[model samples]
Target: MAEAYPLKFQENHKSHWARTLRNLGLAYHQIGDNTQALDYAKHALDIYARLAQDKPKRFEPDWAMSLNDYANLLSDKGDNTQALDYCKQALNIRERLAQDKSEDFESDWAMSLNNYANRLSDNGDSTQVLACAKQSLDIYARLAQDKPKRFEPDWAISLSNYAIRLSDNGDSTQALTCAKQALDIRERLAQNQPERFEPGWAMSLSNYANALSENGDNAQAIDFAKQALDIYARLAQDKPERFEPGWAASLNNYATYLSDNGDSTQALVYAKKALDIYARLAESNPKKRTADAERSQLNVAMLAWLITGAELVVSAEAAPDSALDYDRRPNRFYRHVLLAWAANDPAHAANALENAWQAWGAMSKAQQKNWENIFLLACGFAAARAALPPAFGTWQVQLTQFKTRRKAGLPQWMEEIARRKGFALV
Candidate 1:
């Protein structure tokens, strides 16, 4: 047998030191030490960067690679600000390399554009994100046009992301159009190569369902989501490790459609199944996957509880019953409002509570915390106007006296209620 030299590390080599830091970062990240991983990652990038500055021309590829590495790591760490900086730098390097070297060829350009656009979108900058996603779509579109049979799958994904971003930014109509176009492309591809392209079919079906759901066609959405779920279930069961989360996610999406159409019992069943798959995945390998996916499992469990009024048993639980680790706060508030309304006016308040609870129960945590808060507030105002008693005027007066007497110790929700009633004595 031939003798092999053992790997060795030296103190003075900056490159080796950078590599060491990166490896340590991954190790730390694996064990759920985000802070330490972030520190090590930053140190590695700093060293790589110093080397790039020392030899700018020779280190172009290294520089770009390091920037992307840092960008992705930081983005995962949720430091989107610094992640944006690194992504932009990486884009600049890639653009220069592709333009000045490869004449901006399709393969390299498309890859770079995809990463750049996604990162820009990740940080929630609409203008730049839209521009980059559009540019990438254009590139992919052109490539697919030039070689339809070869690049169709890639093009389909880009178009899907393009539509998704548009939908996120409130252009649901345009989003449906984009999604439809991608579905057309993918359908054709799947027909041409069914054996190799089954996943593409599933993706197109799921995306079409998403667009339909956004457009309020929940009937068609449910049908399409079910079709996708069936395909993904077969594909995933055949290769569990390879397709576990995708199938689980399809089940989740299908369940969401059911939940939206007032079939939350079925939704709870599917969400629970998805949560099981996600839990297994998390236990199998947490560090290698996105935390967003793990968080989503928690979301499913929370929503299941809201739909069924059943408590979810999760791995991360604490006694105070806080909403931080749960996605059921909207439903919780909706229930509180219902309790209040039952006490106030059981007839009209019944309808008010019903509508409000539906809206509140269906919201995702991200949605509830953001623009949905405004909608919730607006709905509260509308409900109050519609359901407020004639005695509310006198009630407001009483609330003013109560507030003045208890200003130093009023609970926040009580204070909000008083303000909402326009009960101001000052």
Candidate 2:
């Protein structure tokens, strides 16, 4: 259909072709055809971008919308670095449009800001996350005040994002308030339109529960988290393809809270459940789901280690007999195990570190040059430092060289991983 439309629509009708391309891209995305989705989205974006270069007033908004759509697809495909770049393009266009006509472009600008905030948050870049979320929330608040029925859902979404950023920034008290306000708005909306608003209400419940947990209200956190889990569970049961990810995410969140509250047994149960769901999803859609699967696997390993007082030994049957096993372990089990043994089981931790080092040494030069691979190696090194700090004296020097060689800013998630393991990324 997309090919037929392009053949029918000549170059003079580029706008029509671009719009069709964008629509097709969206349709493909809805059906989980990410490869075709990206192809169509990029084609639309290219046409719009070229048109906007000559007639900014006529095509800039269209181009920005295409950029946003492309970013969403890239994000879903687990290419967040590219996603961030596309989101910035959309936000820049929207910002300019909003400045010229605030009433007409403010909503779009706010939407872009919210999306930018989300991508940054996912990448562990907390520096500008709060500011972008607040800017989006402010716009939504004003719009909702003027037309509650039309803009209330957008307002609630912005509030929820703002709450997440606030919680990440250590302002959990205000985060809880923001989350609760979003929950109230979603609850009201869902009461009238369950099909439209129930998912949102469930999301808000999870966000609010997270804030509650951060604020040291474990009981309330567990209660709200359970409510979110119940909603997601029901939704997933009815539509596994769409809602399973949400259910898995809720399980992970609930498990973390339970673990923090000294319920290791239940927490392990929930974490394993989340991992099982992620594994199934990854098997069905490897390109889009593998990252989530790996993270959930790590979470399960962490939970098991914690349940054993951080002294879980490598199973004799499962122990690595080859470099292939070690290579797989760095990003999955070994990294988590290294942290668990940082102070508790130094002998095993040293063994893990030695295996990780051997795996790193086995990588080719080209593989080491890739940012994604480098980030994973950096994380492995950080975990090794936590388990054996003195062994990292030379690594600090090498890290400086690595930073100097890279032109782009360091990935914040690597630092986050290191910080979680009680080490700094030198």
* Local distance difference test scores for all models: 0.64, 0.75
Alpha-carbon TM-score of each model against the true structure: 0.64, 0.72
Off by over 4 Å in 2: 1-13, 23-37, 73-82, 119-127, 304-348, 351-426
lDDT of 1 by residue, 313-421 (tens): 3442223233222233444444434333233455654555455455454444334433332233334444455654332334444434333332233323323433544
Q: Candidate 2 lDDT, tens digit per residue, 7-49?
A: 3245449989899999999988776678899999999999999
RMSD of each: 11.4, 9.0
Give candidate 1's TM-score.
Answer: 0.64
Q: Pick the candidate with the highest lDDT.
A: 2
Candidate 2 global lDDT: 0.75
Candidate 2 has a TM-score of 0.72
